[model samples]
Target: MASSLTKDSAAPGTPGSEKTFFGHPRGLATLFMTEMWERFSYYGMKALLPLYLVAPGGLHLNAATATAVYSVYVSLVYLLALPGGWFGDRVWGPRKTVAVAGTVIMLGHLTLALPSSGTFFAGLGLVAIGSGLLKANISTMVGHLYDGPDDPRRDGGFTVFYMGINLGAFAAPLVIGTIGETVDWHLGFALAALGMALGLGQFLIGSRNLAPRSTVVPTPLSAAERATTLRKALIWAGVAAVFYTVVGVSGSYTLNWLLVPLTLAGVVIPVMVLARMKRDKELDGTEQSKLSAYIWFFVAAAVFWMIYDQGGSTLSIFAEASAENSVLGWEFPVSWYQSVNPVLIMALAPVFAWFWLALNKRGNEPSTIVKFSSGLVLVGASFFVFLAPLSIAEGGHKAAAMWLVAIYFVQTVGELTLSPVGLSVTTKMAPAKYASQMMGVWFLAVTAGDATTGLLSIAGVDLNKMGIVALEAALAAVAGVAIYMYRNKVKSLMGDVH
Candidate 1:
């Protein structure tokens, strides 16, 4: 009787269908648990990294140097997504790639749990590679859970999924970063390893419910897919060889190594894809126009990213230097401030989701382009919340913690407005053949942004003073002008697609 009930529950579309629970899948819960823990580990390690470098017995590197290195690390993690996406499209299906990547990430966390310089670098390498694979693919899997393109449940599902991501991110730093500061670094790293293990376990268990990838070649790959994949592999291999020479000769490969090729690809791939589309004669005029619009938005997003991604580099250093913290008669560790944005995200995502839906129903919501532009402006504005306190902190005094918290609260709302919507926009706008590659191109902007952040760190900006305010104001003004000038065109391009 129990076996019969289990089989019924697992079956596709009965009253107890495996595909849904309150307008979502029971499987989503499992993936939620999986992603939550994965984020916990990622954020836990991140929280301690800058602190680890500058602590008394730590690397003893200067602030500028360490932030640059940290930016390089973060940038590499995103830039590698090109190959990771290609690997999913060609060698392994997205699901299998996710599993393999999760295991690799787990190993990376464990590697950092040891106390040796060699282990640190090695672990960083592994984590970067693993993040490349897992980050792109797991999100891809969330879309895979639905059977059709216009599934109503899809948007809600991703919101729930993003909540899980923030849940882990919000909790990990507080728990693991605190432990590292109070107890030991190894224990914090060990916590990361454990978190990843939980994510991997949940992912494995839920694998049975995931829908198969649309691009998975059941028989054998067509000549085109195979040829494209082979070219991609060769391109990746060339990138690796160049990095090998860079590290061998200079003892350090700058973050720019990852950006160079990706930047080129971002330019070239769209042209190549359009050429292919023209040759096939398969795309209609509307489809072609939509693709063109996507390219434009990608360009705008690249500009926005130049400011948005400062969080891990310039903003991080600012927090380390100036943010005030005191709790329970102990000053909170500066790194703990990183938790602020994630915590706000966890609490506010649902509200924003509902708000968008409600506005949509009333025909009163902003268009996608407007929303993106607003996000850019808001991100810029969020930086200024600290301007007063920062200006006053010049003599090594701490700035008020409320300033940072205020910034995060506003910035997280901006994040909700932009991020998931951007993901959905890309998937909707891209042609089926170029979908995965275009997603990779989207990330190239992030790589460029991180590279720019690194360069800014090298410039020695006085982030605790008017510098941050000037930078923020500049971003807001540029974003506002761009959006205002392009308003009609941007709205036309969206063409009721949102």
Candidate 2:
């Protein structure tokens, strides 16, 4: 199986063949910086959302409603990746889709800077739509920079790329959170807009560094077929418009209504995708086996993310209400706590990358599934660690800030193990024609977990408490063990992918 997965050559004079940046493709630097700035905008805005919603000068929503809204907003950001990927794969290609989406995202931030409820929700909608377009396709483009399934550098590339993502995430909360929390919320949003604009400019300037394959439209449709596709898309657009208009006019709409359907879609869409792939005549036996194994990875990722994603919602609430706000005589904003994971990720990603590469050199690297299982266990342990401090704190008393920091640190470790590897594996396993679309499917796992995060937050499940924390820890532990027990079977199903 290992022999079957040997690296293949990239064509000469292509981006994939060049190793101009840290021994990886030069294009990686371009994608890295692009993602960094995009994440800066995205996380910066997110850090402000929960606080802004409950602020007197902002939306004035309650905790439950705000968390619910946050969940829905984040879920949609990933959910929209499905169509975004399809559009890139079949229509505009990754480069153009990212450009258009970046513009739309900037507009969304601008709209958010306005002090009107209508504009606020509308801005969230636009951002969600834009993110759906950019997120998966950008990742797909990163995967394209590698030559084949056996590229030893593939995981390392994604790890480095993930570092770029965290670079943005690390700075965003400190800058934007300070402004939003200490100065004006709208100004913070404007800063986010500026970040996106700068990212767009950089991406455009460096567009030439991208792989030629990143801009190729896979399975391009003929003119007549395209016309038919456009007609169907417009019809769906009309239907969506009518539905939204009715809901808006009724004034009875709530985040719960949105959450129900989104959650269902998260579960159902993956099942449908797997079913279709299984039945596809285009996939070979090995491809089918790899896809089957991917489902296990997908489930593990979803479970891990559901717990980890509380960083922005439930964890935010904890920081605001239950965690000590003062650090070394400075009263840090609760939103700043959101930066902890990113900061740790930036510090730790390179170490993790080197660790994996060293192990691979010794032919002793854990299978992808093993790494994923280990991630789940670590994340579950994070909850238990949180419980240790909370269990002793008196009711209505704030816990130490270090407790939350420790939790974020542990969770960051889990993330390093699972997230980038998941991205790399998705690229390795997906059928070539459905590459972008499959990236969207990978994001759907995150969507499911994010939607679940919203549900738990709305239900007032506390991560700091014994009940919920214990439950999550137990579930993650069990899942990890189950996956480990089945590791051999999964590897066999993966054929040469391990």
* TM-score, structure 1 vs. true: 0.82
List ranges where model 1 is wrong by over 4 Å: 1-23, 150-152, 209-288, 327-330, 458-465, 495-498
- Candidate maximizing lDDT: 2
- Give residue 88's lDDT in candidate 1 (0 to 100): 73
lDDT of 2 by residue, 232-275 (tens): 98998999789878997999787666666666666677678778
lDDT of 2 at 264: 66
TM-score of each: 0.82, 0.87
lDDT for each of the candidates? 0.71, 0.82
Candidate 1 per-residue C-alpha lDDT over 189-254 given as tens digits, one digit per residue, 9 for 90 to 100: 889989899889888876665664523632355789789878997998898898679786996766
**What's the CA RMSD for each of the models?**
4.6, 5.6
User: What lDDT score goes with residue 357 in model 1?
Assistant: 89
Worst 10 residues of 1 by lDDT: 1-10
Which residue pairs overlap in candidate 1's backbone? none
